[model samples]
Target: MNDAVHSIAAKSAAPLPKSAGVTGRTNDPARTMAEILKVATHEFADKGLAGARIDEIAAATRTSKRMIYYYFGSKEGLYIAVLEESYRRVRSIESELNLENLPPEEALRTLVGFTFDHHNGNQDYVRLVMSENMLRGQYIAQSKSIQALNVPAIRSIRDLYDRGVVEGVFRPGVDPIDIHANISALTFFNVSNQYTFSQIFKHQMQDPQVLAQRRANVIDVLVRYLRA
Candidate 1:
């Protein structure tokens, strides 16, 4: 009960480092928004907007319902934000690829492979997009941010297409939008219809072997279509 015991007690009672609370909420707005979006992304993707509950999302996040509303204005606003973040994440990763460094054919093939892998890995993103489309893009249409996010995606394709055409490796008059559509369609179908397709064909669509073969086939189809 003397100085030594008092020192030991004080030391034991002292707070830990800020990083010790790594998972705890902090004043960083970005982290808070990210935490909310991470939880909301799953909720919306699983249940869609109409079925997702604000209270449930708030419960899943470190933040509260009021905080969520404060950051996103409304449930619809939060839904749009989730969609925006989901798209942003995949597109951001795509932007990081050194596409310009690779040859045109390699770049396009790399892109197709990457897109196929990204869609499969991020099934939540695929579901979110499907839910948005099912609503005829009702919530997605509300966000001007998503369009801005997608512009660079199309620009990347256009640049790749232009380079390929100039190199005489790609056919002339290829549309970037069509290129995106083909790649997206091939990749998206794998995730979007995975359940139904698997059931219909009794095939294990989620198998790693199946995915690898499909990935190669998708790249081959795009490469063949683009080749001059």
Candidate 2:
């Protein structure tokens, strides 16, 4: 297998964490960590790893720079943690999709639509990813855990494709990774380039009606691609 496949296979071997949804811990330190991650996520997404300051994040939260360093070790460490937590939260929300009960086509539609909605609503996630890509994924490379966190997302697509094939509703030999890339590309561009796109087209991309139309379009595209 190639590197991507091998990485996904290895990551898939491990089960997701039980508390992948949220921290699930209500204690002080847990709360503090959660708080730090929250502020840090926005800070990093807004200013990036190099541009974002630890003191800024600390001042924004009810925490100190000392506590920030104490919790995350360093600015880079905090940035990595934010990256991991951001992906974890998105994947966690995806895990709650409960796609098993839906028909194959409907499951694919739901997945695509959910992704569109997520990317549209969570601009921070998009910005963080855009910034990371801008830096050629330097911080992402430092976090091996990110690969594991993302594996479930690909596995879900693979499982859905397998089921769809078995049900004779989907074309055979469609690679799950390809499907993911397609879906991500479609949805990600809607958010990552919305500002520039809006300016170029002079369109109100954020309007609710426009979003609804785009959401439907995304679902239709993915469903068509997956359908047999």
Candidate 3:
């Protein structure tokens, strides 16, 4: 080719500035992903998988659809990612509670209370869980690492229960998984059923006094059940 043609082609073919690219590259990819996940969490929780829109999430995060897809591959991929992050966040906080340092009964109570507070305060997490259940957990089942995130929770309970058994405070033969399940059920109900239960029963579940009483009642119920 002639010099003029070669020069023109080179100019035309040269890479665009990173700023000019469609990828929407960020200096802080981790922060960008976190932001996207944060917005997507609400989107999925509020709309579920079938109803959530990537464009809306991107708009909310000041990101592009391409960037979200670049990071998470697809809408379902992002949903799965949000689920992982939700579970990871809860499990991360649960791990940091340091329940092992407390006595078994106290540990159980603390764990239950924390779960209650977490579910109550972070209703989005509960909503995401409920949304997933509505799909029979098909998306959560796609997550390879989510189950791993929850293992430490059960292990923590197991350690505390073993200590309680040794100290003769908690009865023996109870499965740690069952204890975890019971605690989860008791705490989960407070958030999951609050609106419906409150409406049906004609009571204010969000009342501070009522909440305090319910929290104490749940803790008492579990503690009494495990006492030797």
Models 1 onward score TM values of 0.87, 0.86, 0.89
List clashing residue pairs in candidate 3. none
Clashing pairs in 2: none
Model 2 weakest lDDT span, ten residues long: 1-10
Q: How many backbone overlaps does candidate 1 show?
A: 0
Q: Write the per-residue lDDT of candidate 2 for residues 170-207, one digit (tens) a residue.
A: 99988899999999999998888888999999987899
Measured with C-alpha atoms, the lDDT of residue 70 in candidate 2 is: 57
Clashes of each: 0, 0, 0
lDDT of each: 0.83, 0.81, 0.84
Output the better candidate (2/3) by lDDT: 3
Regions of candidate 1 where Cα sits further than 4 Å from its true position: 1-25
Better of 1 and 2 by lDDT: 1
lDDT of 3 by residue, 200-221 (tens): 9998888999999999999999
Per-residue lDDT of 25 in model 2: 36
lDDT of 1 by residue, 170-200 (tens): 9998789999999999999999999999999
Candidates sorted by TM-score, best first: 3, 1, 2
Candidate 3 global lDDT: 0.84
